[model samples]
Target: MTTAAMRVPVTRGYRFEWVKLVSQWRIRLVVLACWVAPALFVAGVSQQATLPVDTLFGRWMHATAWAGPLVLLGFAGQWALPLLTSLVAGDVFAAEDRLGTWRHLLVAVRSPRRIFVAKALASLTVILLMVTGLFVSSTAGGLLAVGDRPLVGLDGHLLATGDAAGRVALAWLCALAPTLALAGIGLLGSVALGRSPMGLLLPAVFALAIELAQMLPLPVAVRLALPGYNWNGLFTSPMQLRSVLISVVAGLIWALTATALAYLIFVRRDFTNLNHDGSARRAVLAGALPLIALGAATVVVLAVAGLGAGSGIGQDKVQRSLATAFAHLYRVQTGQLNRPDVTEAQLGASAACTRGGGQTDPEGPGNDWRCVVSWRLPDTTAVGSAIYQLDITPDGRFVADGDGPKEVNGYFLVRTPAGDAPNPLWQFDGTVELLPKG
Candidate 1:
């Protein structure tokens, strides 16, 4: 073939790959599973009020039409997203090898690059269909089970049904980036490991492993680099724009890096020696893969430690954050926007926090620090105090858990009011930002 002729657009190759993909019974079955499974889950979950509360949007299933999908999105971030995206992407390249059509397809195409692009595109198309299928099915199940109702947001604010639906829809759209990035990772696995099973299994294993690593005592920055760390940002009260952006950027970096590595491997691979089955069998390099993984892991650990070092908020910063968060929480709890006596300057909400016990180490388990916050309420009848058990992120963000005897049930930060009318001055249930002092 002439150079110009060989350089023809890969539209035909793409069409060919897509056609073959659609014709496969396996593809149809996988797509069916993706669609039906989420629907089934939502149907069962919507009938009950006791859904997993550890996740966002799980507290109230019967309360809203959008709860089911939002809850499922949280579970998806754990494993479902990785598995579903990888299911098709992992099969893209390996399917050709498994069916022993690599050489024929390569020969039929004008260039290997065209064939690669076509396969990647097909895989991405499949991932998109799966996401759409799940989203639609979950939404349908939610609406069918429960008629449209106002949703109680994370900040204890009630959102109208239409507004809640819009936010849920936006969240699903945001999820697209992470899923596509996982598809790219799976494609890398498919290319590296010619066996279909390896392609299917490795990406999921890697995703789960990374999740487990995030849960480890590693630095918070390291966990933030993982895929699902900020997934809950989608369900935040105002929707955490910064967190969403960070997660998307991390996903893009992983996807592009994996794709580039896979492409480099594909270009340099020797395809001359094919097994009797017509699949090109590349020799696996001994120890190289493990060594590379170890090195990468070490680099990540060091980077996390470096970033985490001295990143915690000091006493003054913590006090300011506590005061601000307490004021806001008090407003939400009391259903009063503002109280004249609760002013920061006059009230003097002071928090004495100490690190140790539950917070022995910076990255240890359980909430590390406990703060005794004393403040005068709007009535100013007497000084009131409450205990705040907090877990601080490496970047100085504090999340207070008020699950102790002094507070209400579930996780929240509690403050006892000076008067007996409203027992707790502030009952906040979210992360409190501690900004740097200028």
Candidate 2:
């Protein structure tokens, strides 16, 4: 071979990959799907006057243009994001192997490293462009279909339009990291399996598996370990900076690990590994089953560990616990966390807990217990009492609801903190002060 033909510059490899990628119909289909899907989703949603309360920003989408991008993102992350990324990334090495073109590439390219890097660049470029297309199309369609009003936050507070838009943009930027992680997964599957279909299928299945694991009643730490675990932090009230940062770091780690592992395997494996009847392909495919089994085993271990330990309780202790919980809850709502009136016994607090008809197992699963609590209102001479419904979990966390305090309505209650506690003393899910309606 001529020296001029043998020396393939770095840029030439990348440019060649780009040309091959654009020449395929998959890239075009992905781009068209990205723009068209968002438009259709917005159109269908606009037809219904009702907001999608199930999804993040579904309610906000009816009024705020900023919500459009967020809503689109929320839905896309579920499945579309994985599939779109895999469509391009998954095909990188697998398609070439399927068509028996890797040998030709090996002869044409100076090094396998160049080919791998070029394929990765092409895949990353595809994902970025597709995501940008979706974001822009969704945002434009949302503004035209919905009004550009202020968005209602997760806390039911209104956020400024400019601020909400800025946040939406920032959220999209943060989302790119997770997209890269999914692409990495796709690339790994492509290189390992050397089949186009498996490349596309594995990443989506991997995403679905991680998502399902996250939804299980696992410990916070275990859940956080899953992919895309903290991606929703962007849509959370006040924007969960800590979770977002965690997601960014976790995503980068996942992407780097998967990509590095794929590169290592690809570099060592013989070119014949890409063949259908090769021993390498048979060994790799057979090895997949054990890896899958190991993954399943890991999930089972996590689930069991996450469950922790909880003991059964009798009704008497349940009543006593409710009474104590109510007293602390009242003190918390009244802003007397440090006072002697309740905790120090300078004054008295009382509660009567029951489960109707003199039931024995008030704290039993699926049973709703009732409690009538009495405590003096803050800075008031008279005492206030109200009936409340308590739902106690197996783990002892309970939610108390009633006509509520004279000044404010609380949704839940938490255990009292010890001296110099690190976290907040109160852990109410939400609260609304009483307001007189005309």
Highest TM-score: give the candidate number.
1
In order, what is each prediction's RMSD in angstroms?
A: 6.0, 11.0
lDDT of 1 by residue, 341-382 (tens): 244555566777667853453233335677677767665589
Off by over 4 Å in 1: 1-8, 147-163, 234-240, 276-377, 380-429, 432-438
lDDT of 1 at 27: 80
- Which lDDT values do the candidates have, in the order given? 0.62, 0.62
Decoy 1 TM-score against native: 0.74
Model 1 pairs in collision: 359-368, 402-412
Task: Determine which window of 10 residues in candidate 1 has minimal summed lDDT.
Answer: 429-438
Best by lDDT: 1
